[model samples]
Target: MATDDLNKPLGLPRERKAHRTPLVALVAPPLLIAIGLIAFFAFGDGPDDPGNVVAAIDDTSPDQTGSVGPALTPVYEAQSEPLVEVKPTGGLREVRGNDVIISDPSKPRPIRLAAAPFEDLIEADENGLLPRIGDDGTRPLDAYARPAGATEGMKRIAIVVGGIGIEGEAGQSAIASLPGEVTLGIVPYGEDLPATVAEARALGHEILLQLPMEPYNYPDIDPGPNTLTVAGGTAKNLDRLRWLLAQTTTYVGVMNYMGARFTGDDRALAPILGDIADRGLLFLDDGSSARSRVGAFASDSAPVIRADLVLDGDTAPAAIDARIKQLVAIARERGYAVATATAFPSTIARISAFARVAEENGIALVPVSSLVRADGS
Candidate 1:
């Protein structure tokens, strides 16, 4: 009977025991929860999240293995020189020291002729139709450039740079990477379009003026410091355009930079297109607008060539590479492809490297205008 009473007298120890049980129970649930959370995070399906999909498929390409698109084949070449001979100092017609008349035949004696189309005046505008006489007298400057297919053994690639806004270290370096025979595009309103064009020309790259016009955002969009706007009336607009185009001495043609409003206005652009034709220059419409009047107007008015693709619309290195491959494929398929891409460190490097690949694949990079003749067959 006394044993039960003695056990009951340990009241302080009993109370401590009761408090310890609840504390242990309370702590166990939280500790277990923390461990479960760590396990879930460590082995969870995180990669399957929507945020990772872009990273996964960003660089994927159908022809990732470097297979060419179509076999290249020859389309055309010059049979004979197409330039006309002009005599200097020999009479009413003469032949002076390297000087000859490049005047248009359509005009009368010192007359006014509708300056022949860009392709037609090739021999006249740039020093009077002598065809850059080689010592052998066999070179043909007026002859059509030969069009070729991307066969198993052809190696040619056109390198194109679309945007050149201002002269920074990065811009200079990007321009410097272009190889011989590559084509370059410069902004007509850049800090120094003339200097940039001349520099590119000296390096043996063909040049084009990237014209700025109204974009989708219109008044809201600043197309650099100088842009051709509809509100400026046709005459002022034309004058501004002409001045911009003239700023670059090296450009062989002009291409649209971005034009949402102008592209929709056939009536306003018709005369501008006519002027482009009148000036013996080609026009390239960068595919910025689905309702572009430039292409149709060009077909009817001048030697117009529109850009097929903007290669670096998305500037990721891998994306640029895929687009380059796609352009190559398209060029091979149609015997020629014309694309424009902005100048970026990654894009320039990738394009410079791709030029080598193009040569290996027999895809020659040419001016956008060359494709018309290339695909004429």
Candidate 2:
């Protein structure tokens, strides 16, 4: 039913580096240094190389290490005309080409820094094909992510009830019944995806898109229309993926619907995983099959956190309760645990009741994101 962080470099095209007016350009460091040395030694000025004059006014900032060597610095040739002398009127001002500009010192300069935090870096296109995140410095997925909210010594348990939005009423009930900390997975075919997402967000539960990928049964037991398949090849699969992604927004990640066969094939899953990584989203394995390649494929390309347990494989009240207890035990033993289940009414009731009581036992039920890697790496 359900569904994961870690960065596999998404390789999204680099946003233009922010254009900054460097401190040297404004302060004329080279000019000041040259003037000072001359004044101290011979009480006279040195010959002004137009190259040095332009270099002194260079707005190019430092490199990755914040140090620039001459080889790395851009060389602006001396124009046939002599270099123009720029007088500082005060504040932040720099020379570009032959013109000198002045900026108000009191006002803040606008810098659309690509390397800024996630909130600043995320930009939604009009089509919203597949949203992309900026460099590793900005992880919108992690910024919008959830923490366990557990006490210092509490064992954390995170669960996701998948298959929401397929059967409308059933989906609604699952959203209302389950605690907000429990994550919900929505199908792309939902009659009203936006409304469902809005209601789920209102309830404080994080949403994930459930993609229908091919299963072992194939045509005999189809998950849904447009199931991602190896036969579709990488290009077609990505096209299908774009459609699924367009259905909603603010979802933290995506998980497979019935992808046992499709997920196991690396040739089919690798490119898909890369796309997921490229976007600022997580990937949940659902742990539906032992042979699923999501775990290994994720570790190598896009890292994922596979479910530690399937909460309602048997859907019976007693079975679900037992699984909750087992999950709590595992969490207590391992410090954190992850579980996935369908939206069966009985399953929902049993796990909800167990989650309420588990807290009294020092087990903190957390959002599924608690198990995700924060840096999305």
The candidate scoring highest on TM-score is 2
All candidates: TM-score: 0.57, 0.65
Per-residue lDDT of candidate 1, residues 170-234 (tens digit)? 56765566553455668765776556655554444556677788777777877764577767668
Candidate 2 lDDT at 314 equals 92
lDDT of 2 by residue, 1-377 (tens): 11101212255643456656678785796799988877755532234332333333333222221122121223334664333344433223444553434333543222111112244534555535445675665444565554445357888887888888886677888877676678889888888877787777655577778999999878898888788987889999988888788777767788899888998899999989888877767888888889888877655336477888798889789888888878888888988888899988888788767766776799877777656763345
> Which predicted model would earn the best lDDT?
2
Quantify all predictions' global Cα lDDT against the true fold. 0.55, 0.69
**Residue 48's lDDT in candidate 2:** 36
Q: Report the error of model 2 at residue 109, Å.
A: 37
How many residue pairs clash in each candidate at the backbone level?
20, 4
